[model samples]
Target: MNRIELATLIFDRLVSEKEKLKTEFQNSDSGIGYFFLDDLLPNDIALQIHDAFPKTEQMVLKKSLREDKYVAAQMNLYNPLLEEIIYAFQDKRIVEVIGEICNIENPIPDDNLYAGGISMMGKKQFLNPHLDNSHDKDRNLWRVLNLLYYVTPNWEETNGGNLELWPNGLKNKQITIHSKFNRLAVMETHNNALHSVSPVTYNGYRRCVSNYYFSKSPLNDSDRFHVTSFRGRPENKLSDLILQLDTFLRMTLRKIFKKGIKENPHVYKKEKP
Candidate 1:
């Protein structure tokens, strides 16, 4: 289906249960608000998106102490359906509906897709707990919400690669939201919203379409500008200390260089040809 058709399908589904989603997000635990919905689209359509994903070689491999995953933001390089579905959540109606549910005002979707797009994880790939960057690509608007849509078929909680929200910091157990097929998860992003993805154990890929909504105001009054900070899991003390130092160094650099020393190359530069 085209972008409009796909967006309409998702919008209708969310509209049908807006009140339930609004209530759930407002009352979420850990001081970080969130809500998820399964069967976000027709099963067949979601399956098509999974099938259309590009091969591993075609995507950018982001592997380090922080995380290991494959991501693609240059949408034109992949199947059109993948791009369509990625932006479907960015549709104005869908964005407004999600904003209303989360009680956010005047939230704007990022066209540059700053750190937002398609991501896939294979066996043993994991993302350590971290807070996303606080602002848009230019460090202008505050990032207020994160939208993730999972399309990997037959994916189960046992398969791993599920989203882990560390609402109470890394010392406590996380709230795991399985990256189940046809599921859409929305989470509020702020100073305290620490989250990560469990390592994938199954032999197959767990795919997701991601987007972020920005606003002129911070989610919390105390929110401050910071880079994407990483941390070790609850049991890894040494690693956690090391990551803390790493964040300190990066934060220092940003203070010296408002935009950092180098440009982040993860944005989508739509091809003009």
Candidate 2:
């Protein structure tokens, strides 16, 4: 029907399957933690979401990949139902349960939505492997978890546009999490958790709903202050060097200007009705 109904339906399904999903994540051998539910929502509903998403004009890129690897729409559209569904996940009870799956205790999401929004990628677009920024708007809270819901139908693995986790760093092999339809993949975000979206090779588009959960405490003590760090793939040594320098320069700038050289414009800006 609408975004709310679809989100609610998906939430109900996920809640109903919570125990199993939790167990799957807990038992996984991959330190690159995740849980996925198939056939999460009806095809029609998924199509509606893909169709209804707003333009990508307000989207921001932390690095070159967001521009080269992604062409996405942000979901700040006002819909009480969608908010309630998001709240269902935002609620402490749900967040705590998910936190338990990720082996974290008592987690809370920063009310301010930042780089959190929707994402879409078309052919030739690809997000290079990178770690999310450690903090939110004011740098007061640490982003601890990433909630990604893929809604693109029949998105094939061969087509690319999947999430990749490099828990062991870019030198080693990465764990690729397919951007499957109706799959909700939640992973821990931190300084060590290097991740990215594989390039979309096919002609079609891949769409996803993305949100991040933040907490007062850093995911780990070693997670020192840093900006969103990015790197080239294992094979791209030159790109890696460039990205490292890019991160260092940005972090250096942040040291000079605490809030950032300029405000990030990716956030949802509301206008009076």
Candidate 3:
């Protein structure tokens, strides 16, 4: 189905749970704010999206101590349905309703797909806890929310690749939100929203469609410009030290170069028409 049709389905589902989502996010506001809703779309449609994921070889392998996964923002090369679903979440009707649910006003969807798109994590791959880059690609707008839709069928928390939130920091245990099939999780992004994905244990892909909403104002007055920062899991002290140093160096380079020495290629650029 087209994006408009898909968006209608999304809005209907979300609005149906508006009150529950509002309270869920508010109750968590003392730390990182988040709310998740399962079965965001018809099971058959979600399965179709899952089946449309491109092979890992067709995507960009972003491997580092910081993160290990395959992501694709250049959507034209993949199945058309992938692009459709990604932007369907961007539809104004859905975006506004989501902002209302989270008590964020006038949220704007990112059309450039800067750091927004599809990702797949297979066996042994994982993302360390990190704060997302503070702003949109141009560093003009504050990134206020992350929209993650998981489509992998029959996935389980024990199978791994679960979403971990460090509301109390890594020194304490994290709260796990299973990467369940057809689950759509909306989490607030700000200075303190440190999150990551658990390592995938099974050989199946933990596929997700991601989108971010931006706003002219910061979520917290304490929010400041910072590069994406990373830290190893709680058990890896040495790795944590190294990753902290990595973040320091990157932040220092940005302080000198403003936009850093190299550009991030993780954005979609539509063909000149």
After superposing candidate 3 on the true structure, give the runs of residues whose Cα lies further than 4 Å from its correct spot: none
Pick by lDDT: 1 or 3, better one: 3
Candidate 2 clashing pairs, residues 3+ apart or interchain: 69-125, 69-126
Question: Model 2, range 70-150, lDDT digits (tens) per residue?
Answer: 322223553333344344456555566677667776677654457766666778788887888888888888888899878
Tens-digit lDDT string for candidate 3 (115-231): 999999999999999999999988899999999999999998898999999999999989999999999999999999999999999988999999999999999999999899999
Clashing residue pairs in candidate 3, if any? Answer: none
The order of the candidates by lDDT, greatest first, is 3, 1, 2
Counting only residues 3 or more apart in sequence or on different chains, how many pairs clash (N, Cα, C under 3 Å) in candidate 1? 0
The 10-residue segment of model 3 with minimum total lDDT is 255-264
The lDDT leader among the candidates is 3
Which has the greatest TM-score?
A: 3
In angstroms, give how far residue 56 of model 3 lies from its true place.
0.8
Higher-TM-score candidate among 1 and 3? 3
Give stretches of model 1 more than 4 Å off: none
| TM-score for each candidate, following the candidate numbering | 0.98, 0.85, 0.99
**Number of backbone-clashing residue pairs for each candidate, in the order shown:** 0, 2, 0
